[model samples]
Target: MRRPRPIAPAAGQESVWDYPRPPRVEPVTERVTIRLGGDLIADTRRAVRVLETSHPPVYYLPIADFVRGALVEADGASFCEFKGAARYFDVRNGGTVRRGAAWNYPNPTPGFEALTDRIAVYAASMDECTVGDEIATPQPGGFYGGWVTSSVVGPFKGDPGSLGW
Candidate 1:
């Protein structure tokens, strides 16, 4: 399939098209925050991001940053060709519950070991997810967990008819 030309990135912006195909992992120092059901569920400055072509960065936070008792294991699993199998978690705070709102790779594929036990939440499923000063917009489609910020540009994948790209 012929991929569409990437949108030109303005200064200070990164085009998702520029990301690699196999994905790359890198540490991020920006503060990441996740709030669900009107409660702060996770916050951390120590995070990592997975960057892949046509997708926004997915931020993974250390398990220690989550509010105690907020993440309850849920009954579901998903597989990633690059990251290995992932387990789901329901985020509960106060009386609010978001079913299967987060996930973690317990045994990530080699080279992705940094992700093991680090949880990444679905930005769309949370009340708010932010990186630094920008609030995130969740990547389109429910299957992927990428958080779009102002610094990223895209003709991103996951929209209707985007599968062939």
Candidate 2:
């Protein structure tokens, strides 16, 4: 005879039980400095807080924080379901440096409106940047900046799941 699979003792049983749920999530904001050409390009005095489930806190800085004259508008734009629309910029340092390497949200969704007028530049475009005392490195790839350490999360720009740089 063939053996049948055994069922659990509590099959179809329903009962009220007390259990602790996960903690509520909140955004974390911090001040930072982006350095380029031996000068501080951006000083993030006030920026939006970011808290993804698997990622660390990222502060979204405003474009105005950067020296506007230092950045030239690039010929590119992207749409995001969450943040709304984004425009790109080329880091102008002597020559037409990195192209479309940085981006920002001119107008963002109400939930993310705090990022509006904020520019998140390509970390690679600059010589260096710093969050407090810790120096920030270029995020990787030809463009894009998730703004975290490579060891934590890495080389995500040119992945198959992502579009062209």
Candidate 3:
């Protein structure tokens, strides 16, 4: 399939088109915070991001940063060709419970071992998710966990009609 035209990024922004295939994982210097149902569930400065071509970055936070009882292992699993098997989590805070809203790879592929102790949540599942001081928008579609911020531009992969992208 022909690739979609990429949106040109501004001076301080990155085009998702420029991200690599097989994805690249790197540390994020900004603070990551997640709030759901009026409770702070996860907060951490030491986070990692996985960037893939045509996709916004997927941020992963250390499991130790989550509040106690905030993440309950849900009954579901999925396999990622690059990251290995992932298990789901039910995120809870106050009266809210988002089932399968987060996931972690207990035993990741070789290059992705850094994710073994990390969890990635769907931004839309939380009332608020921020990177640094900027609020993150969830990437289109329910399947991807990419977080869209001012730093990245896209003709992203999960948009409608992008199934073959």
Candidate 4:
């Protein structure tokens, strides 16, 4: 199978190809906002982003930034090779409820300690999600929580026929 070439990044853009294979965690100073249903549930400048090759960055917001009682543990869990066990959360705002809308690693694996207890929401599960001034488009598949922005270029993973990437 022929490998897809990544798009060339413009002057201010970044190619996901340059992101590392094991992923890297870095602090993001840009504002991150999340709205569920019709309510603003999270707004924070203190966030971390995990970047990996062929995938958009997944932003993790500190749980302290969420509204009181806005999140409740939902009944499902998953495991990641790098991040360890992840627990799901249902976000409740006003009268709207989005089940399994967010996830977090309670105890991340050795190199991913920055992810512990920080929540990463699925942008598709929210009414709106933004990073800095740009609204984020959810990564192509439902299973991966990556936020795609104009500054990033991709032949991104998670789209149909991209699993082999």
Report the C-alpha lDDT of model 1 over 1-165, residue by residue, as the tens digit. Answer: 777777899999999999997999999988999998787888999999999999999999999999999899999999999999999999889988889989999999998999987999889889999999789999998888999998999888887778888
Question: Counting only residues 3 or more apart in sequence or on different chains, how many pairs clash (N, Cα, C under 3 Å) in candidate 3?
Answer: 0
Residue-level lDDT tens digits of model 3 in 1-165: 888999999999999999998988999999999999987899999999999999999999999999999999999999999999999999998789999999999999989988879999999999999999999999998789999999999888789989998
Give candidate 1 misplaced runs (Cα > 4 Å).
none
The C-alpha TM-scores of every prediction are 0.96, 0.64, 0.98, 0.96
Identify the candidate with maximal TM-score.
3
- Mark the 10 consecutive residues where model 3 has the least summed lDDT: 109-118
lDDT of each: 0.91, 0.56, 0.94, 0.92
Question: What lDDT does model 1 reach?
Answer: 0.91
Measured on C-alpha atoms, candidate 4 has an lDDT of 0.92
Give the number of colliding residue pairs in candidate 2. Answer: 3
Judging by lDDT against the true structure, name the best candidate.
3
Candidate 3: where are CA atoms >4 Å away? none
TM-score of model 2 (CA atoms): 0.64
Candidate 3: residue 41 lDDT (0-100): 90
Could you give the C-alpha RMSD of every candidate to the true structure, in order shown?
A: 1.0, 11.9, 0.7, 1.0
Return whichever of 3 and 4 wins on lDDT.
Answer: 3
